[model samples]
Target: MKRPPYLKTSIGIGVLFIILMFLQSWLEKQPEALTASSEPETQTEATAVQPSERLVEDKRVYEGHNGTNLEHVYITIFDQSAVPENDITFYDLNESYKQYSNLDSGPKLDILFQTGTAKGPSDNGFISFGTDKPNATIELRGRSSRLEAQKSYKIRLQDNGGLWYGQSVINLNKHADDRTRVRNMLAFDYFRRIPDLISLRTNFVQLHVKDLTDPSSEGKFKSYGLYTHVEQLNEEALAARGLNPDGHLYKAENFEFYRYPDQLNHQNDPNYDKKKFEQVLKINGNENHDELLQMLDDINDLSKPFDEVFDTYFQEDNYLTWLAVNILFGNYDTMSTNYYLYSPLNSKKWYFIPWDFDKALGRDAERTDGLPQWQQGIQRYWGTVLHRRYLRDPENAAALTAKIEELSAIITEKTTKELIDSYYPVVKQLALQEPDLSYLGIEASEFDPAYRKLEQVTSRYKEQYMKSLEVPMPIFLHYERKNGRDVFTWEASHDLQNDKLSYEFQLSKTPGFESLIMQIKEQPDFTYNMAALPAGRYYWRVLVHDDKGHEQIPFDYYRDNAGIVYWGVQQIVVPGGSSS
Candidate 1:
């Protein structure tokens, strides 16, 4: 067969194109070579600044990591030696359990940290540390998780050192209570995709640590197992996230929107104690707190309408989106704390940014039963003054519901299911290895069910959100000993329909209220008088009922060491010879 001239030329070009495509594919499949040196592989100014520029332009790729984006990090601890020329040895690094008691605010230890990159699925990561002695300080971090044998950590780059992926402080969360180990990361990842909400950067990290505190010990780095590296919320983080770094930022340590006259005064006030102020709201950026105090004052003043204050002092979309995300995720711990408040220098509006979501997505519910019975709805936020005022209005409540529905449509069950599926294989094998396995909250055999349960956790919370709109907000119960008698009092519940309300008060010896020592029902008054309780401990609760037959429990709850929450229960202890 004879071919024409043009046909022959076309055949030649086709063959060449296939060969080049095969060559490119082969090159792409190969692993990336290890960097020759560890001094951060010097880069031109432009190359170094491009990522940050891209961050300002495109937020989608900000701190974005895939399911398979598992990274390895090595940290080597060293003593505070004055001699800079001394050789590093196993004796330089030491471990002492006595110093680990206060992980919440303990002093940090100087450590040399290095990170590795794996370009492909089959690549084995490597670390390089050349002449960069110790550039950071590491401290045991977390509130309750500090009690766990395995601990989370806070790593801060010190001495004007280089940034770790454009961050000064890095929070590596172990999520000790969550067996799935990815609930916190999942929440942040999902929020990152939502436009209305401000999201932080997060990635999966595998940590290795070596302790040379003991002279006789070998200083080999041991696998600390898998951790989720959540970017610390600070001025640097805010700037990177496109926020006003020079604006006010405060982490709610124990703030409930109260105008604490004695504690939370301005820095210029004579009685203003920084320690006392920090106990309630930890100052993170822009120490000037006049705006925050003003907002708190407005929230505390019942004379001002909440909607007006909300419109004047808050971004409506930001507030609603934060509330809606927390509701759907079931992050009930945010009533007084576990969130950040920010206000730009030029604006009167305050914004809510979520933090510490480890307890969200039914992770707590899986460990505890009946925890969400009272904590599941808009009423769950009644403990906070701001939320109480906001939710008391029907319009704001409906607005929150609409926001929840909007987010629900975007982050559907299938969407979450795919996320869980993607994250499962990445941490499955690593979770079973070394330290993580020893501290595993659930059995190895239960990972499948745990993840499967997580897929439906958010949706279940959404259903609860809808049902919560049917009931009134839970009342705040008060107790005092008055003239030899025990008096129980609580605020009247706010019903949307303006229905007649009645109270049912029950006193019990056990927390579960299995047997009631005293039961008072169908009472119209908010106050109940009873004889002095015995010199032992007792439990009590008040249930609210409406004319249309809607019932709701109180906002109070009792939490045990196991994280089990008993809702609507309050405890009283009587001294043998004194009325209390």
Candidate 2:
């Protein structure tokens, strides 16, 4: 009855095999348990690691009116939250502002705020302001982490305390036309009506306005306005064309109301008509005759009919007329510095263009002599004193006075007031068509204040014209080294009395010698040995003190005077020991 031993052994082996299969099935069902065991370890690895933080900063120069320069800038971020340990790097916006090391002096401003993540805290982040020049460092103890994520920081600059002049913003209300319509119309007109014009289409969008007017909406309204026909020259463009790179050529952007001066373009020419000079001289016999003639020559040479010049100074009268119109509006800021005379590429002719029309319409003064209210609005927004000094030269002053008399005859009191009345209705109609600007307190009724102010300023300008008629034209001279010798030059003049029959030279490149260089008592033309000059830039100016030790008022020729006038770089080696 007992089973064979082999059967018992086989039965035991089958039971063991069954148990093994059951274990395998249970393990397959426990996959969740295995994954749960590994989760904590993966998260722990991630939590223990931190991201690296790095920031890159850059600086550059931005140029403005009358050789005024600004530092343009940008920064790059590599990490989201980590703070940079080193000071940010800055680059010079222009070569003129570069230090000895060729580095920008950085903004010398300081920011003060409470420390916190919230919006209203001081010391929230390190804030800097002002120039980076020596003895101008303003630093604070604060973490850089407070800077907003994925945002840029921009700094605007001014020379003197914000008093002298600085960047400003202007917000133009949308025109009577809608955005799309304006864009299309401008494009069509640009192509069909004025093919030579360069056009940029801007919108009334908040962001575009913000970019132009930094520091937000609180900036002065003088910074923003609508100036339709402003002309501006591109100095860089003209330089590229091998034309007069000095920025004396016509540019379309110059037509902006804020850019052109309120005065006439041609002033203080030595070559001014003898009959006119005699009239002015008779009134102011003590006037510096020689200096006045030189200035007239320079002005005429620059503003003369472009066709008459030796292929370099030719400009169109239509462009000049546009400038004249802007000037008539009392936009008196343009001159040699801010305004430009430009010649197009592949063309020999040059033209004048208006620039920066923000101060037009005499906004700050009362209506007088029936000048249009809009034309009088400019007095409210005066330019820097430097502007007045440059624009009111004897020639420009005289010419402007004549033009104003002419304008007065044409733009009679009744007609000027009528123009104002017409402008009010049109502006009112436009306001009704557009509602967004109402929020900014701009309504048709407010136009009167702007208009009346312009009128008053225009009257003052007329007074200036009368006074200028009593003064003789001013004179000036500039000398540069050509062919390795100093060539004494004066502004082109027709008057024999204003010609540089002789001159004296005072040479000093360093700032210390400025006084000595200015002290040359007399001489028509003087030359210094080239061998005496060191291998570096040298500056020298001519003092055409006339027969007397007196020169024209320095302010009259600020743009032409007070800068490096010569160069003494290392000699270049040419083939066969001939150096050029």
Model 1: worst 10 consecutive residues (lDDT sum): 48-57
Question: lDDT tens string, model 2, 520-571?
Answer: 5454334333433334544444433343232321112111135422221111
Where model 2 places Cα greater than 4 Å from the true spot, the runs are: 1-312, 316-327, 340-342, 363-450, 456-463, 474-553, 556-580
Distance from true position, residue 459, model 1, in Å?
1.5
Local accuracy by lDDT, each model: 0.73, 0.29
How well is each residue in 1-580 modelled by candidate 1, as lDDT tens digits?
Answer: 0012112247677687677667767855655321111112232222222211111112533634453488777776764462243334333212223455434445566677677543211112212333236667777677676666777788887644467777878788888878888888788878767755667778888887666553444856677789998888887776664455777889888888899898999889999888889889988888888888888888888898666777778766677888899989999888888999877666687778899888888865666474645588778788788887877766666678878888988778888888888888877887876778877877888877877888888889999988878787788788888999999998888876677788999989878999999898987789898898878878888999888788888877876567666788887777773343
Residue 232, model 2: Cα distance from true site in angstroms: 8.9
Error of 2 at 111 (Å): 26
* Top of the candidates by TM-score: 1
Error of 2 at 201 (Å): 9.2
